[model samples]
Every structure is written in structure tokens, then in C-alpha cells.
Target: MNQFKNGDKAYVIYRNPHTQNVATIQEAIITESPENNEELSLFLMDTHYPLQDDYAIYTTYEEAVKMYNYYFEDNEQSEM
Candidate 1:
């Protein structure tokens, strides 16, 4: 089942492996999947990301930030 509809606003936490920078929150738009009608995709950074478990999509910026802090910031602090 599709959790999002076309044109819906969404948020995602992006972490660049090449740069190894802190995770940043990015805003995206839910769009109809070009490959499948039953699924939805995220239009982010001029790219299409399929709405799958591989990418965690949030409904709000706060939610995305909270998850980012939990996974990234907290881990970094704990390592110190």
C-alpha cells in the first residue's frame, strides 16, 4: 500500500558517504512512481527515490531531525 500520494510534502535525512559530513534534513515531494502505480517515489535533489525501507521518509522536518539526531548525533556523542 502506498503511504503517500502525489504532490505530498515529505522529509528525508541525507548523509553523503563520500563527504562523511553530518546528516542533513532534506525536503522532498511525493510523486507517482514512474515504474509502478501502486507505489510512490520521492523527488529529492533532482532525483527520484523510491519510497522503500531503504530510505526513511518523514512527514515533518522535526521528525526527520529527531531521527537524524538519534541515529547520527547520539552515536557520535556516545563515541566520545
Candidate 2:
């Protein structure tokens, strides 16, 4: 299992049962999911503004960081 720590950036991937469109992880919140027997859930904020919602979770901190960099790499590349 991947270990996720607080403050780590992550990408949430989930398909809404209704729309069936892939959801984006705009934000990551490390917390426990009461419905899943207190298992840790990475709360993801949807990229769709005004409809922001928690989407999915990452198994490890490294995975989360990788996702973050992948999504926002343009900014880093410009700095280099």
C-alpha cells in the first residue's frame, strides 16, 4: 500500500456514476474516511470551479508529489 502524508500533493481520479466523465484532483486533503472504516482518504477538490468536491486518494506520498509535478511542471520548467 502507498503511504500518504499530510501536505503532500496528489491527483484524484474517479468516474462519477452519473456523468461518467473523469474527474480531476484540484486539491488534496489527507483525512480519514468514516464510511471506509476510518481508512485514510485523500480528499480531492474537483478542478471544476464552483463544483469543487473531494474525488479520490493516493496510496503514497511519492505518488502524490509526482502527480503534482506532472500537473504543474510548466511553472517549474520556466524557472529552470
Candidate 3:
């Protein structure tokens, strides 16, 4: 499983590419299910925008990190 430390910045996918949205990693939690399997939920800073506020689910934390970096990092670099 991938681990994301608190305070890492992440981007949530937005419907419009022109209007980018990003969130800061506020918390990470691991919960045990009835099957004794572990699940993860990454809490983000509340975005005032309705569309951007929420937790995004991923099978693994690694996947979430990748998705977050892909959209956020690439865009930031290109802007520079």
C-alpha cells in the first residue's frame, strides 16, 4: 500500500481542465473491514467550491497519490 504523509498537496480531478482544483492532504486513515481487510480514506482540506470538497476513494493509497500528482504536478510545471 502507498503511504502519503500529512501536508502533501494533491489535486482532485475537475470536470474542466481550464479550471484546476487542488487539495492539501489533511489526514490519512486505515480502517479494518469485516473481512479483516484494510481500507484507506484520505481526508483533504475542505474546498469552498462544492465540486471540489470531498474524499476520493482509491483501492490503494498509491493510486490516489499518482492521480493527484499527475494532474497537479504536470500542470504546475507546464505553467512555469
What is candidate 1's lDDT per residue for 1-80, written digit by digit as tens? 25678999999888886887656888999987788877788999998878887787898889998999889888989999
Off by over 4 Å in 1: none
* TM value for model 1: 0.83
Clashes per candidate (backbone, < 3 Å) = 0, 1, 0
- Estimate the Cα RMSD of every predicted model relative to the unseen true structure: 1.9, 9.5, 9.3
Alpha carbon deviation, residue 65, candidate 1 (Å): 0.9
Q: What's each prediction's TM-score?
A: 0.83, 0.35, 0.36
Which ranking of candidates, highest TM-score first? 1, 3, 2
Best by lDDT: 1
lDDT score, residue 72, model 3? 76
Q: What are the runs in model 2 whose C-alpha is more than 4 Å off?
A: 32-39, 45-80
Shift of residue 64 alpha carbon in model 2, Å: 8.5
- lDDT (0 to 1) per candidate: 0.84, 0.49, 0.44
Ranking by lDDT: 1, 2, 3
